[model samples]
Target chain A: MGIREKPTRMDQVQSWRADFPVEYLYTTGVAGERFAKTLRERGMLAATRCQRCGVTYLPPRIYCQRCFADLSESWVEVPLQGVIHTYTVVPVRATGEPSQSLEVIAYIRIDGTEGGILGRVAVSPEAVYIGMAVEGVLAPPAERRGAVTDIRYFKPILS
Target chain B: MARKRESSPQNPHDVGRVMREIPERPRGTPLKDQDIREGKVSLIAWKPHLEYRWDSGVAISRFLLGLKEGKILGVRCHSCGRTVTPPRAFCEWCFRPVDEWVELKDTGTVNTFSICYVTWDMKPLEIPQIPAVIEIDGTHPRVGFLHLLGGIGEKDVEAIRRRVRVGMRVQAVWKSPAERVGAITDILYFQPLE
Candidate 1:
């Protein structure tokens, strides 16, 4: 007959903390700063236009890549309606962070605009589709600022 | 060339005369195939780690600063009459130079949006967050952006839609002064019109 020996525990569980350091540096030109200030005080959206191609961007720019020409200040107002381009639903949690359930994401094309914007989908994940009309929702007066977050997520425009 | 005869050394027992002995070869240990396969070997555990530094352009920096001041800014293309929110220094369309500044009305409508249950890192947020695309008023074509929505409950999706229609009035909600930074975090979220 053979004899067998029982295994013994060798290591114990332990916890420790480590520091995570991150640093960020950024710089903005004079024209860009002025553009942002205008939005903050005026509650407006601005973009740069191509002098040669006649194309307008939602977020304004300084130089024209096509014509390589210096753009002149010619601010114009745009409509607040658009169509849905694409969408998705996100449902995942991060490690060592808060937990959430399903989330709706979408790409929206503003009315009369050629480009599209990416953000959260306010509608049901199952209800979203391409070519659906939508619009922007601005923040309160007290909360109004010349920032992207100034306009909350776009909700489906029923009327 | 002269030839020479070979001569022997005076010492009869010289070290060079003796044959050098070779070292013995190492012996191999024999073992069963099963025993060798079942044996355990030491290993080191490893985990993946990554780091990055984002470079936001000058235009983006200004836009973030504007958010800190509670504002939404866009740039305009003088040649094409287009307005861009989250202002860009250049125009992507028509390949032209955009050198204009336009301020958009806070009152706009929802172009489209999503209710975010996850954070920016693709992880679940502690609380469900609403992200939407809003088109600013008084801009050529339709100008829109992505942001958080408020003044509506999580289940009240329809109500939020009604309040943030394509042309409904809406405004931005800013964070406290102390917490204000020249970044998107400046504005906590946007609220429905009263």
Candidate 2:
């Protein structure tokens, strides 16, 4: 009816350690496919505009969240340039281990679009800053694959 | 007689209607898993390592400790008078803390069983494993826990199925003393008992 006995020592207590070995596949949706295709084939940035709210979405979407408009047929090519909205300097790798070098990850707001896409900034962390003008550097046309990685990375650009 | 309400934008009963053009077929590109495999479309693949450690509390801790010593432990609920193995602290029916720790025999009866042809990750196994609910001795009838059935020594499912049955006597096959760990895995499996 009451507490009889419990494992006081940590060693006496039983514990198990294991890791989830799971693999996942993420499909590029309708708008995502169109965006990737345009970037790969033409080296251009494509966006979908909501006619009702006049909001342009980069990494385009099929539906407008704000005005609830169908944006599938509103595909447009935005400028292949952007301004660095925000950034982070990571001293450690994704595996939670200290890295020999620092990496700069940033969200770049594509020109003439309402939303931004996350990208790696090629320059040193010290050189990266908010509002810095940057242009996307794409892979060679022959080697281009239909992925955001097709734009290898963004580099500093002169205004 | 009710008065006729004028059609105004602010009228609560009047529903605003819009003409929508519906397409003959569903929109957007659809690709099969095969298409992605063949590189027809883009897909992102990720494999993340998620680690975890689980603590075996009061009753289970003692139970696991008992298992490490090649013994099975159970808890008896004085209120319900039912002793359950793979023990728990509290009694489910009476909603009271268990009274005494009872060491049960490492023997049981097969309550139900199934022939598993695939492993946990769905990969086909060379020799199919038999998993069954074994009602441990000294516990209430039908009070059992799931464990694997081994020593069948047969690769054919039909042969194994024919040999195994409900109410068949089974005894826990414990690992060697050196291999003993405070875990259910200490008992490799349950085999048919005479």
Candidate 3:
């Protein structure tokens, strides 16, 4: 420590408040673009299958993670219904503030694929359970944007 | 060199085979920013906002306080005998603590200058700004800080560039006492001394 003459009063100290803003753009890749476009235009879920490893990916990827196989040309339409693989009840908002209502956030295991997508389930926290069959409730075709939010939420499938 | 071959013809297939195989394989579809704008593709946009506070420690704290009082302050390193403005607590050369403070004249000479055509945010500016490194009076030569220059009375970029010169004498144009808040900005800018 360099011993030196220091200001005794707190008033002698100075501080500044500042903010840093960074803006950026990210493009959905080849398979991801196809998945978004298909969901947006046709109100259907799209996936890709690796011909070499036979593993399917949701939010379609260009390459298979396991075998590093190119799956660009193996796009497939997945069903709208899936089973809840796991879920948690969030009683607060993302900012950690108390919310008026609880939400059931879950990982949905899509039918005919090993991978899953995260979504909000439209059911009571107590009523929702693992392996519960749920169908995606998509926004109207005209209202759909190429975003995952186009599928508003998942609800229990009718018997 | 005339007799040596880069590789034996039998083994030349190693790299060439892979090069030929790549073109036939299916590749990812490429899209441009135009595609995203035209709604032909999708994108994800995110902006995170963060706020922070910075404390102006020992030397800078005193310097800023002097600015609020309408004075320019600097530190003197006894070991090197060099006075530095926009003062620091330690002599970087000698690695010795600097505690002596000196009051410097607001006037200085421009060591270097630049005419900026755009704002810090990269937006086009109608009247280009003139920023310069002004070597403060009473400080060692070339020991100066960057500050904007003003009062040239010219808005055209070329005219300002023609007028401003290295070694031109300038004086700080301080803000009204009430407007100052112990910040470097207290000195609005440096104006050429007539």
Candidate 4:
């Protein structure tokens, strides 16, 4: 008669390893696609208006949130001038990639509009404020295809 | 501004009625289908593509190597005069470089901990694991690292902090050499010193 030795407990913990699948793909729809294109073509700002209540939206939508009505044809052209509402200087790289540098993101309240838009603030993070005036600038029409980056960023327009 | 005298029989709806003359333009033109289609097509054709990249750097990789060798590390903040566990290269408070490296004791006490019934991605975890906040000894008073605790029952999670007091002894339980990767998961868990 013979007895056998079982393997050490540490060996069991060491044997645990498995592959993790992590993949992500995101796509935007037609309404948003059209909004981006308009910004690039005429360097114009377009927002969605509720035909029922008359409230305009910066990032245009097909339906009105407050009125719960279809806002397919209720579009309006908004002036580019706006005021900086709030901003932050992001100094750290979020992902482990090498290309990220210190940048600033800001919330801008357009004139005569109820809400605002969130985008990269095209100014030194050091010299930004809550009441600073900003103007939206679009990329050249020939180069635009349909995306938020079409408008490069909101730059402080010194007046 | 002239006031009119009442000369007729009273009507309930006539209290606020007023009449005004109107003028009109020669013609009102409706937008043609070609114009509407042109506007829609022009709008869709102008969309732009946005792209950007960010880098987190090699701080985590270096810290994992220290843990694999059964050592605890802390990053020192010169500006605020404090050491932080799970070493950060920058002091979040002072916004300055944290260059000093301090080795902490393998032994530590549980400050606070939670028994995680779910996995990292919020799915139900197998074999129920206990994730503890281990306050390492001799580096910083409040500094702690998140790790699993062994030699205790899952039901004993609430009592772990009471049983393993603020100054209790603990040690790292390392996985086998073949399983060593530059990751925090390399250490299976911490066990109480008997």
TM-score of each: 0.38, 0.86, 0.82, 0.40
Candidate number with the higher TM-score (3 or 4) = 3
- Give DockQ per model, in order: 0.01, 0.56, 0.47, 0.03
Candidate 4, position A27, lDDT? 34
Which of the CAPRI classes, incorrect, acceptable, medium or high, describes model 2?
medium
Candidate 4 chain B lowest-lDDT run of ten = B41-50
Candidate 3: pairs in clash: none
lDDT of 3 by residue, A111-136 (tens): 98978889999999989999999999
Preferred candidate (TM-score higher): 1 or 2: 2
Candidate 1 chain A least-lDDT 10 residues: A1-10
Chain A superposition TM-score per model: 0.70, 0.89, 0.88, 0.75
* Alpha-carbon local distance difference test for all models: 0.61, 0.86, 0.87, 0.68
User: Candidate 1 lDDT, tens digit per residue, B2-95?
Assistant: 3333344446555566545654655333455564356321112234354554545545655665665667777777667777786766788856
Looking at candidate 3, what is the lDDT of residue A81? 85
Error of 3 at A114 (Å): 4.2
Complex DockQ, candidate 1: 0.01
Which lDDT tens digits does candidate 3 get at residues B1-194?
Answer: 66468543555545554444557658556677787778665778888878999998988888899999999998888888999988898999899888588999999999999888897789998888898999999998889999999999888867886778899999999999999999999999999896
TM-score of 4: 0.40
Q: Write the per-residue lDDT of candidate 2 for residues A19-137, one digit (tens) a residue.
A: 88888988888787788889888999889998889889877998998968888899999767989999999999878999888988999999999988898888898788999999989
What range of 10 consecutive residues in model 3 chain A has the weakest lDDT sum? A1-10
TM-score of chain B of each: 0.63, 0.84, 0.83, 0.59
TM-score of chain A of 1: 0.70
The segments of candidate 4 whose C-alpha lies over 4 angstroms from its true place after superposition are A1-11, A14-27, A96-101, B1-194
What's the candidate order when arranged by decreasing TM-score?
2, 3, 4, 1
Q: Which candidate is the best by TM-score?
A: 2
